[model samples]
Target chain A: MPNATVAGITVDRNDEGFFTDPNQWTEAMAPELARSEGIDELTDDHWRVLKFMRSEYAQKGTGPTVRVLGKTSGVSIKELYQLFPKGPAKTAAKIAGIPKPRGCI
Target chain B: MTSRIVILGGGTGGTLTANRLRRLYGADEAAITVVDQDDRHVYQPGLLFVPFGLAHTDDIVRPRARQLHEGIEFIESAIDHVDIEAGEVRLGNGVTLGYDVLVVATGARLVPEETEGLLGPAWMDSVFTFYTPEGAAALGAALATFDRGRLVVNVVDMPIKCPVAPLEFCFLADWYFTERGIRDRVQITYATPLDGAFTKPIAAAQLGGMLNARGIEIVTEFNTGEVVPGGRLTGYDGREVQFDLAVVIPLHGGATYVGRSPGLGDELDFVPTDEHTLQSKAASNIFVIGDAANVPASKAGSVTHFEGETLVDNVRRFLTGEPLEAGFDGHANCFIETGFHKALLIDFNYDTEPVPGHYPSPVGLPLLKESRLNHLGKLLFQSVYWHGLLPGRDLPGLGSNMPTAGKHLPVPEKD
Candidate 1:
């Protein structure tokens, strides 16, 4: 419930970094957030996947599942992993101004 | 006074060791007693099948007392601690036991709480483990509703019981979802702290290829530091893996009683044992076997089967004031389930890794390769485990030491 400042943003995050207030995430904080996750640069392909997750979550109130992302997000599951390393969905959710999608991937 | 033997634990090791020692010393020469926390003796390997509905919980569990020899005593009580210097053990029920020879076989205990946030909000909801009967049953139900998303099977750390089990789970999951007609909807992943699929190169090469054939993604060197309820696994190095369903194999340590008994165990409470003799390094009169021993060999049933020969012989030698034979070679045999009505078998010892070969006979079961014959052999072992194995009856030609009679060992490639 506490708001911790991460990547120059005063954001509320759970202990494991699930965002409490999705609105606290700003475009300005993404580069630092990306650096913390071991991604040196967020390329155009990464944005395509990240924006797809954000647009899907804003409409459905939940991020797209891995299968849905592979089929509809213009990126395959293998490609999604290449974009976000170990955790594609959760990591994308963090940077896309969305709460960590609840209830298993 | 009759030379009394006290075996701590009622699992595969204790049951077999107690029975074997009784046969070796006869009723008049020695008295054997086995102690455990409960009467439930589970066929541990069968737990893997439970999640897929291939094995029932009741079918895999039996009374611990029923496995012992006729004259051996079965104590249905929890152990408080053992006083090694005093040669006595105190039970939680206020019972005291004294032994001329002590056998510590109280195998590894699952420690999920050791990992940060593992027992968190999604403990049994999305995050489930199949290492225990209850966990397996819960995962079965979770998998029933789970038709989509990334399903990850992660082994928390190394030196876990049944090392191949996590890989076996991944293989079976492929078959399970395929049979359910929703294989394409679900994504399968296997995450381990190890650098590869298995410990040995030859077997890992084959098994790793099998995983790729099934389209299951492999996440190697993933040392999970925590599990968040939102279906995320965080690694020690700050990487993370997200999953819809997670089947976790937690770290294992020696039993709690081992910690209470001073000078009896390693830092992890696994008894520091001589690999060849099965005798505890702590004391000459004490011996350790099965998963309880801090041996380099696997903590599996076949290791206990092979150790029984040398362990019983050493007990007899100790009673008669003779030198103990360093007969055990840390031989281990494992049958890995690759799903789809086939399995792979491997045989090894302290020196040899699994290679292409035949076991026992030159034309016997295939090694390091999947075959229907190996699958049948694995299924047949349930009966053998109950009848021949626990009774300490050794299969002829299957000795404590490994043989290279028919194995095809390739020369090491230049680095």
Candidate 2:
């Protein structure tokens, strides 16, 4: 784990830049993290996916996959890509300040 | 009074649990009954080889009752629901089975209808799934005639039983096509929801490299949304991968009866279990194993086999008013078939990822690397599963916990 400064506050992150301890994250940190992933602004759609991810992780001890976010987070799969490019589950999870999703091999 | 034990689903989990418990307790002390809907217990791992024409349904399929030990009772009936409050399992025929302890091992069910257009007009025609005996037989017939086209193996969602089977399908297809001298005419694609060829990083890199070498195109992070028969697969992210022949692994949920039972299942109907203890969170008297439990381990037979060791012991303790030992370590050992008479073996647990080494001992079968010996092991396992695993006989060196002696841990990356 390493300490990094984002949104003018220091937080613990893994080598992959995901928050190690999700409790250390705050809503204030989403903007700066979004910018790093090349999202210029955090729209309401983006927040919807992110908030669902955090709340799901809080309850399930794991972040939701892209399908779960698309199906239940009220975000369509097409729009999830536009909100978070490349990989929606991987990218949104990082910006949402949560650990990477765990799927069995 | 004798302790009454009722186990649900006489598949791998229930059979093994019943056999192990029978060996642990005499019939006078504990009366054990195993319930399942049908008599056939299809060796699930054999399903993978069926599509490749290496195995047949008759070879793998056996009567569920025949596999159990002499003393254990086997009941054939559809499970209706679990009356958790009353500690009873109600069957469809209004027969009620009261138990001092209940083990739910009904396993995951393939719900192809969960995906849009998966079970559409083209199903069993151009599109197929090899997860079931009929599906595998149908796929085998379809594959034999398939000479030239875009062949795609798509995994619809995660936590599917035998997570590596799709990759094996791709590998075997590559071998099958090459053997037919039409390898150049056919193009293969592997589409998965995971962002890599596998969940483990090292194994993914290795398996991904094999896919690249075999010229198998891999489309990652593709969550399948719809299946257009004989045309294309549309992902939730709106990415389309065209396919002439599609072998789709559909979304898996626990048995439907699980959903009907109160406090027994999650949204997906899998039992919410304490990963370490294999005890259902729904009640202390209930335990879960195999694909029925929502544990983070791969939903493979090896997991159920490993979990059996701890689960049976804990069941004994649970009956005696002793403290339940959190003995299960989520050890999963899998033999991955990479085609062309070669395969790879991986041994891992909840805490450790697959690493390069040998298993059981330093000189044992190689792990995370392909070898002919491993392929033989994979073939030999079918017999071992029927005789050794089902009978609850201990596999000398292989235990409930993962062995770390032979593994070579990856060197930390220099930042």
Candidate 3:
């Protein structure tokens, strides 16, 4: 089976439960995921932006551009960069548990 | 650090005020921050045109933050409460933002639950509202399938956003059914809480006559109590009006956070603001605008557009320790669509109701009379709202003050 590496954290492709059911993604695993990506701590703003990005992608079937994401989330571009640091499209997509958005390379 | 200017509710009022303030103050002097729960800035007026296929849902909506200036910060969090004495705002995420001046531009919310059985099993399938984007889209679908039936457009209560919208819906529904070759199959009824077709006597007479000529039934003084699915609309007086499809304007209230803040808003959750000054009655540094304000004026976008100029000036005064200027005179203007490629324009303020005259001048756009010229003006305003109104650009001769040039004033009877 192929494994998916999101922000340096590996998840087995056979783990259908976590992918299908968002409720299964617990907070205890958040720290481990963040640590794998070399992050220290997650702020309330970070969680808020991540949750919003995930829901938007689920509904629209497309990841938002930085402009659309910032506008819809009501977060400023500078603040988004400060939280993600690796760029909003990449970092937000990774944290949101979605596949990497297209054209990021 | 620069003085913090916090504006609540990033709808029409917050977006326009933030942009106008950015234009007025330099970045070093004042820092503007706008906070809203969500970012969808729906073009409310376009909701009226949606069901008639005049506008698609995408044409009217844009991201709320896209409308603001780059210097202004945007916060997407639910407002928990306002500490007026501390001059700080509390968010649901446990973050407190301090501000020197606050603008409560939080627009009104549609309280469908307020009306009994309005959100019951038949909601969105049989009954609907066009106020929200989702509601408008659903209503568009329902309208398309409605080839023949008793199509009833009812207003659940007053103080709704865009008071003329329900009337516009009726006119457009008439036009739509006719264009679909189902006018004979459809029976259109307009139910209102007012005694006449409209609030103003002269305008009501004019509009009521037009509705009658079009064969649209008018049901006045109807205080809608419940929407019984199998039954009909049960009024408070036990009167029932049966219909195959019901388009109801549910009760509207200010933001839920307004109710949470003590002494901040009225029973309707609307803030008690001085109609002229736009200052909140609860706090000196706070001001309210748009549909959130419990002022005696039409809750329409044009009112917010007119109030934008005065509100920016008052916010500046509040910061500099100067008295607020009483400039906003309940100025509201609306383009009343009368169907069949025609619309009517009305311009007035607190001291005046809609009077028959040319707007801006004695020979400009004719008011209170249907014309194709007004319909073009209505279409032109969508662009004006995006480029001019939201960006805080001034329109020529269209100031905050209501013009009295072309109106017909009643002369006092000689003794």
**Best-matching candidate per lDDT:** 2
Q: Worst lDDT window (10 residues) for model 3 chain B?
A: B406-415
List model 2 lDDT by residue over B222-318, tens digit each: 8888998667999766789999999999998899999899988977888989999999999999999899999999999999999998899899899
Best by TM-score: 2
Q: By the lDDT metric, which is better: model 2 or model 3?
A: 2
Q: Tally clashes: model 3.
A: 0
TM per candidate: 0.79, 0.95, 0.79
> Candidate 1: where is the Cα deviation over 4 Å?
A1-105, B412-415
Cα lDDT, model 2, residue B69: 96
Q: Residue pairs in steric clash, candidate 2?
A: none
Query: Model 1 Cα RMSD, Å?
Result: 14.6
Ranked by TM-score, top first: 2, 1, 3
Off by over 4 Å in 3: A1-105, B412-415
Worst 10 residues of 2 chain B by lDDT: B406-415
Which clashing pairs does model 3 show? Answer: none
The better-scoring model by DockQ among 1 and 2 is 2
Each prediction's DockQ against the real complex: 0.02, 0.50, 0.01
Tell me the deviation in Å of residue B269 in model 2.
0.8
Give the DockQ-based CAPRI class for model 2.
medium
Better of 2 and 3 by DockQ: 2
